[model samples]
Target: MTSVWIMLVKKSRAILGFAAISIVAASCGTNAPQDTWQPKGPNSKIIDDLQRPVFAVAGIIGLIVAVAVIYTLIKYRDRGQPIPEQTHGKPALEITLTIIPALILAVVAVFTFGAIFKLAKTDDTEMIINVTGQQWWWEYDYPTQNEFGITQPIISSGQLVMPVGTKVLLRETSRDVIHSYWIPALNGKRDAVPGRVQTLRLEADAPGIYAGQCTEFCGLSHANMRMEAVALSKADFAKWVANQQAAYVAPAKDSLAQQGEEVFLNQCVRCHQVNGLMRADGTPAIAAPDENVWSGSAPNLTHLMSRNTFAGASFDLLSKQCRDEVWNAPSDVVGTKYLAGVTEECLNQKDLRSWLRNAPAMLPMYANATQLKATGGKYRGMPYLALTEDDISKLVAYLLTLK
Candidate 1:
């Protein structure tokens, strides 16, 4: 029995030693760019500050308690000693321990409330953006931009764009089940619940791409719901807005792109809009998302290539080299690099073709017409359109000209 006890202790020590080594190794990489601990904005910095001391205190208390328990077990073991008195219910010791934890919690509550109030401040906010969460993507709408001298609202999805050094307010809600909006470099996660609005403040110290994902478990394609916050220079941001708001030009006559436009009218126009596509009688063509989509919305593809990513940002629109040129660029140059958009040679054809071929196969989606009867005829993703090779090639051509 004694030998068995010693063997068990040795195995326990070995397991504990391996765990400690693994934890130390994990802690070594503090320089990860997307790490929540490495705050890039004021709000995140405040959270970082608030958590550092809290974690330190927790670590110290845990270490102290563990040491005391270990010491008691080693020094007061029941090897040959007489049974101690029934001192478990000693009022003084119990009171001391309980009061200590209570006081610590009180102190923590004060600091936590202070940080919460601080992070919630939107009085100094200069701009407001509406963020809507659907099953697997985010929609960002700038309701008003008078300061930028823009009267018309701007709506975009897949990526959220902001100007550096601006405290922008994000009013968030959902169209379906609850989803969490999180961009680790900007601020903490905020839940987007249907019928209720939640607000989160986001600011970036410099121009760069900060990747984020829907932290809340949503549905079939939840893991594919990724997003990015692109912080641009003020001058470059104005340029982008101007470009996005520009008029959409029709494809030239007798061109492949023009032929693709015809294919789109017959196939893609049901759930998408080209803004000014003329019908046979020269009437304006409008996308009827309410009739076809579950969320009563679809991603507006007018300026699809202006952003680097597409399809809920799970896939890149540009080639690996060009994408790296934009995301990995220096902060000062990131804006200019991003505004370049996707060029003909830099387009990622493989993924885009595969996505067009079978969207539901690429990502799990509740898009089957028969399967979505439970949603009251609403769909959670783009259904498979069964495009022919010729149709897909033409669609790709037309989509590329969207930039």
Candidate 2:
């Protein structure tokens, strides 16, 4: 029995040592995009400030308690010694410990409340954007703000774009299950519950892309429900807005892209929307996703190539090298690189083709005919589109012109 106990203790120590080492190693990592410790905005800085001292106090208290417990165990071990007389309690020691923790908690509460109030301040908001979450993607809609030159509503998906150094308030809500909107460098996570609008304040100190994820456990592709916040300078943001609000240009006559437009009208228009698209009868080509999609909507792909990523941002539209060029570019040049969009040479054809060939094979979704019945014949995700290779080529060509 003693041998077994000794072996168990050894194994426990080994496991603890491994866990400690792993945690320390993880903390020392660089280029960790979602690292909460690295604050890039005022709101996140508030959180970082509160966390640093709280961690310090907690670490110190934990170390002292651990040391005291270890000392008592060593001093009172039953090693052929008679049991010592037990006392009822140490009133003074108990009172001291209780008072110390209470005082610490009081101080922490004061700062914590202050930070919360600061984060919740909306009176100073300079801009507002509506964020809506669904099964595996996020949609951003910028309301008309005349002061900012936004004359009409602009809808985009896959990434949220905002001006740097601006107090942008995001009014978030979900269409289906609850989801969380988070950009670790910008602010804390805010839950997007169905039928309830939640607000989160976000500001970026510089122009760059900050990655985020749905902290809430959603559905089938919950892990793949990622998001990105792109911060651009005010001037650059204006340019982007103009581009987004610009009239959609039709494909050139008799081009392969024109053929792709026909294919899109025949096959893809049911779920996707391309603003200003005209039908053969000269009527507007509007999508009817509410009837076909479980979430009642799909991403508006009016300017699809303007975004570097697609498919809930789980896949990149650009090849690795081109993507790196945009992601790693200097702050001042990042916007230019991003605005360049996906060129023919930089397009990631393999993944796009694979996705078009069979979407279910690429990502887990309740998209099969049998499974879709539960959604009332509505797809929870993009269903498999058995497009011929030639059709896919034309579609890709047409999509690139969206910019």
Indicate which candidate wins on TM-score.
Answer: 2
Q: Write the per-residue lDDT of candidate 1 for residues 88-145, one digit (tens) a residue.
A: 6889998999999899989999999999999999899988889999978898888868
TM per candidate comes to: 0.93, 0.94
Off by over 4 Å in 2: 1-28
Task: Looking at model 2, report the run of 10 residues with the lowest lDDT sum.
Answer: 1-10
Give the per-residue lDDT digits (tens) of candidate 2, residues 1-403.
4555456556556655765675566556675889888899999999999997997687667657655655565555567787667889999999998998999999999999999999999999999999999989999999999878899999999989899999999999999999999999999999999999999999999999999999999988999899999999899998999999999899999999999999999988998989999998999999999988889898899999899889878788899999888888899999888887889999999998899888888888888757566777788999988899999999999998999
Error of 2 at 38 (Å): 0.7
TM-score of 2: 0.94
